[model samples]
Target: MINKIGKITIYVNDQEEAKKFWTEKVGFVVKFEQEMAPGMKWLEVGPSEEEFTTFVLYNKEAMKAQNPSVSVGHPSILLSTTDVEKAYEEMKENGVEVGKLMAMPYGKMFSFNDQDGNNYLLREDK
Candidate 1:
């Protein structure tokens, strides 16, 4: 039985650039990285090394070449944070493109874009 969600794949134009964006700008750490081919890699990054789930940054062109039917578009991902306001400020200061912070009925939330223009939502968990 499926007990937990594992890794989500994110198709990117440049794996290295995506790694730098997630690690340097978004405060994520590289959980794992392996060279899949001569110039391709299987890269994973997450909020921390201890995080249960990680994002796999796959090369879009290579994926398309392997399977034409596979969607290479970015998925809509929602991430959680302990303090949305602080995270927003930090991400902004780190040169991350962010939207205005909004207070939802549940909590504060905001949207941010990666280097490839893929958008993701960040919400306060508590």
Candidate 2:
């Protein structure tokens, strides 16, 4: 049985730019990177190098060419943080497009967008 989340695939117009946004803005580190072809690459990023789950930044155009029926839109992802306030402030200070924080029934949470306009939810892990 599958017991853990391994990787999440996110399609983007430009992989390099997406990598920069995740690494520089979101503070994720590059977990892996390999050339898939002459100009395409298999790139992965996560909160830390030791994290098991990763975000796989794939090329939208290439995926479309490979499989016309493949969905290239971004997936709705919920990320956890120990401190919502600090995360919100850090993301804002890093120039990330972030939404206003709110006190949800579950916890304090907020949303942020990547360079490709992919939205992700960040909730406090209390």
Candidate 3:
């Protein structure tokens, strides 16, 4: 049986930017790195508050499972943060395009897109 959403793979056009944004800016640790396939690179960023990791794959074969060629679907990915405002402001200051904070019936959320145009929703943890 499936245990949980193990990992989310995010395809990136720029490895350097993705590494910087997910690591330095978002506070995720770089789990590992190596050559994914000939010219492609593999860098996995671990979740700051959880036991999950997001893969930054470049090779076509590695990204093949993400269907229709999209690694994610609607709402793409949801990352939990302690402070949505601070996270939003920090990302914005870094020239990362993000949406304004909005209060939902569940919690606060702000959207942002990665270097690959993959959308992500950042929510505050209760």
Candidate 4:
């Protein structure tokens, strides 16, 4: 049986660039990176200490025919921050394009867009 939601896969244009963004600013750790089928590259980045998330970006043209999502824009990478205000501030300080922090009925949240136009949500209930 499926015990939990293990991983989510996203496509990006530049693996290295995405890796850096996810790791450095987003606080995930690189788990594995290498090449894949048909001259395409594969990368998986996540939090080293705990289980985070990952996205794999392949070269655009090669992946385009498949209508892979990355060719159009970045892959969504959602995150949860304990302190929404502080988190939004840090993102702004780092030059991250984040939407104004908003409170939701379920929780507090803010949307952040990456270099590639992908929108990610930062939410907290805890």
Alpha carbon lDDT of each predicted model: 0.93, 0.94, 0.72, 0.71
Ranking by lDDT: 2, 1, 3, 4
Q: What's the CA error at residue 23 for candidate 1, in Å? A: 0.3
lDDT (10s digit) by residue, model 1, range 36-100: 88987889998997888999999999999999999898888999999899899999999999999
RMSD of 3: 3.6
lDDT of 3 by residue, 1-126 (tens): 986765666666567777887777666778778885666677778765466656543434445554555543333578888888888888888777798899989899998877656788899996
Q: In model 4, which residue pairs have backbone atoms overlapping below 3 Å? A: 29-46
Q: Where is the poorest 10-residue window by lDDT in model 2? A: 104-113
Count of backbone clashes for each model? 0, 0, 0, 1
Residue ranges of candidate 1 with Cα displaced over 4 Å: none
Candidate with the greatest lDDT versus the true structure: 2
Model 4, clash count?
A: 1
Candidate 4 lDDT, 15-45, residue by residue in tens: 6777777777766787777767756777777
lDDT of 2 at 16: 95
**TM-score for all models, in order of appearance:** 0.97, 0.97, 0.74, 0.76
Measured on C-alpha atoms, candidate 3 has an lDDT of 0.72
Weakest lDDT window of 10 consecutive positions for candidate 3: 66-75
RMSD of each: 0.7, 0.7, 3.6, 3.1
Q: What's the true lDDT of residue 97 in model 3? A: 72
